[model samples]
Every structure is written in structure tokens, then in C-alpha cells.
Target: MKRIFLIAALICSSIIVLQSCSPKTTSGAPAVKRSGVTGNWVLNNITFDGIPDIAVKSFLGESSYKCFIGSTWSLTNSGNGSYSLPSSATCAAKTQTIFWSVNAADGTFQFKKLYQGDKAKNVTEGYRLMLAAADDVNMTIKSPIEYGNKTAYIIMNFSKAAK
Candidate 1:
């Protein structure tokens, strides 16, 4: 009985480990094709909390215009797990480096922007963009930001252009 229980436990743990370490597939092999992310992706919803006051102040005045930002994110996959955002429609500020990464094995996408501030040297933060479905044209990304009294979220939705 003891040996049997031990074997069962081992098997369970091994399965867990394998699943955790397994290579992630975004949309399987086809998803990572040479021209991946060509289709349109809308920002359906965004959820984030624990944002600093400083960040919130940046978007306060233009609350109405906030929605206008990030309208489109055109992704052009260079190769491997790397890609580029040829143009980001709604970003008002100027920046130097923009980085994009994807977990082809897992189907996870991330975009980062590096900025230099007065107090800090260089701060880089971005969100993880998740696809809705294989055929779904909507995608959601979440990021936290501070609102009026407390922290709140700024969720936006984006729709893909029809071919």
C-alpha cells in the first residue's frame, strides 16, 4: 500500500512539473507563422489595480481622449519569438526603445516600453496581451492605474479589420 501511494504521488508531481515546463503554444505552430498577428486585434477589456498616483495624473486631463489611445497595434513578426509594433496609434509621448515578446509555445504576447524619468533612470513596464480564441478577433490586455481617490482600471477594446 505504501509503495503504491508513493508511486501515485510521484506520478502526480511529475505530471504537474511537465505541464508547467512544457513549451507554450500560442495558436500551435500555425499561430507562429512568418506573418503572425497580421489579423486585427481589438482591446476588448483591461483590468489592473495598484497603480501609483503619478501614473494616474498623466491620463486625468484627457480622460475623454484616453480611449483614443492605442487604437491599433500592428504586429509584424520578424522571426523566432520576436516581433515589432510598426506603429502604436495612441501613445502620445515619445520613446526610444519598444520591445515585443511572445511565448509561441504558450500563445502569450507582451509589449514593453522603456522610458526615462526625472527621478528614475529607465523604467520599463508593459502588459501581457492574450488572444480571445483561434478565430476570435478580439484580444484583452490588463494594466493597473491609479484613479480619482483610489486605483482603478482603464479597459479598452479593439476590433480587427476585415480582410
Candidate 2:
């Protein structure tokens, strides 16, 4: 009977030692938060193929690039947005409503024109801008445009507009 008690006590003590010596497990690091792209943005700078281009600068004029400046590009949570350019001496008055989306997998930014009342036909192909960098306040996008016979990439820098 004494031998049997000793054996049971040994097993119980071994179990307690094992439980105390076991490694502790903890939760992993917290998940990273992704930055959103919905906001009003204004044009900050423009470049071509990472360098300044004289032709594009001349074409875009000193004031506006395809009527992008002065007008605010408003992006919504639903990926729908609009920008209105008032009638100016250089360009006509126009309002453009568009649907935009950014593909995280490929870092592709796409913009589809929903309505352009000034134009006779709606734009179908739309613009595909490659997202270079985007944060809460700043965004950089690259767009390939056919300049004459050669292709040139237009890099546009945008900053979040103040309320």
C-alpha cells in the first residue's frame, strides 16, 4: 500500500512540474490598417517619365491640365465622384461624373466616365492610372499617353484638399 501511494504521488508531481514548465503561447501582433483613398484632391505637380517635359507642359498650359486644376476631384466611399470646370476663355464649361476604383492586387487605378454632358459621345475606354503611392493626404499616379507616335507616361501628384 505504501509503494502504491508513492507511485501515485510521483505521477501527480510529474504532471504538476510538466504543466508549470510548459511554454506559454501569446497572440500575434495587431493587424495593420490600410489607408483609404476617398477624399477631395488637387493637382500638386506633373511630370513625364519621371522628368519634366516641355511639350506636355505647353499642352497642359500654365494653369490647367485637361481642366484638372482649380476644380476639385471629389472621391466618395462608393467609388463615384465628379468635378466641374467653370467656363473659361481657354476651355468650355464642363462637368464630369466618373466611377473610380483601385485594384490592390495590381496597383491599378481605373476611372470610367459616367457622364460628360458637353461631349457628344460618352467615353468608353476611360483612363487607367497606375497607382505609384497613395496616403491619406498625398497620391501619385502614372498615366500612359500617346504623344505623337511615341508613348509617354504622365506622372501626376495630388494632395488632399482642405475643407
Candidate 3:
């Protein structure tokens, strides 16, 4: 009985590990191409879904969600990028470096902020946002959060910056 229990435990753990390590998207969606995501994008607008705007105090673990408006994000095919925030009364202006990737099948857009001398692989924590849309002209992503014991989303709107 002891040996049988141990084997069962091992099997369960192994399955969990394998699934966690899999390269698939968490939503099990088919891989989407990344061409639309690489370019200069302006965070043109932001909206709250199924929740009041006052419910969200900050975004991307940074300043208030409103501060990100008009921010310019430049993503390259090499997975390197940065977003420059415009000056706001509640948020200071700054440019932050990041390494980002989009899951081919799942539309899971993830990025990790990189500090000086920091390696992307060494950064274990990052932010994940759903890639709602992306193309040569526009892109949209949603940041999901828990609110009132229910799921809420912060919708982000982006437009390609002019050349």
C-alpha cells in the first residue's frame, strides 16, 4: 500500500511538472503570428471592462493606468523593447526597458522589465496580458485582474506610430 501511494504521488507530480513546462499557451488557443506586434505602438487609450475605473489604481505594476496613455512602445522582432511614458500629474515620465514575447498559438503576450546588467533569463517575474489584436496599424491587449471575487479586464488600445 505504501509503495502504491508513493507511485501515485510521483505520477501526479510528474504530470503537473510536464504541463507547467509545456510551451503551449495557458488558454490552449492556437498560435498566432507575431508580425503585427512588432513595431512602434502608441498606447492611444485605455478602458475598464466590467468594473469601475476607480477600481484600478495602477497598471503593469507601475503608475495609474491613465499614465500609460500616449506612451510609446517599441517592440522588435529580437524580443527587446521599451515604453516611454508621457508626463502626468500622478506619474513621472520615464522609459523602461523590457524583454517580451508572444505565444504563437495562444496570443499570450508576456514581458519582463530589465534593469541595467539584468539578464532576461534571470528575471523570473513578469507581466502577462492577453493579445486581443495586432496588425500593421493597430493592436489591443487586455490586462485581467481579480475584482469583487470576479474577473475584470483593463482594456488597452494601441495604434501604430507614424513613421
Encode model 3's per-residue lDDT on 1-163: one tens digit a residue: 9999999999999999999898963555435577769989999999988889997877887858888999999999999999999998888999999999998766889999999999999999999989987878888898889998989999999999997
Error of 2 at 9 (Å): 42
Query: Number of the top candidate by lDDT?
Result: 3
**Span of 10 residues, lowest total lDDT, candidate 3:** 24-33
Instruction: Give the TM-score of each candidate.
Output: 0.38, 0.60, 0.80
Cα shift from native, residue 106, model 3 (Å): 1.6
Q: Candidate 1: which stretches are off by over 4 Å?
A: 1-38, 42-55, 59-70, 79-98, 103-108, 113-135, 146-152
Alpha carbon lDDT of each predicted model: 0.46, 0.68, 0.89
For residues 1-163, what per-residue lDDT tens digits would candidate 2 score against the true structure? 9999999999999999999999975444222112456788876666678334665643322244645545567888777787666566776667778777777656777777775463314456666667777887888777777777777788878898998
Residues 1-163 of candidate 1 have per-residue lDDT tens digits of 9999999999999999999999975534334421344454544333345553335434313333244354445454541122122233444442233345666554555555544442222435555544323334554433334466774654445566555
Model 1 / residue 132 / CA error / Å? 7.5
TM-score of 2: 0.60
Candidate 2 clashes between residue pairs 3 or more apart in a chain or in different chains? none
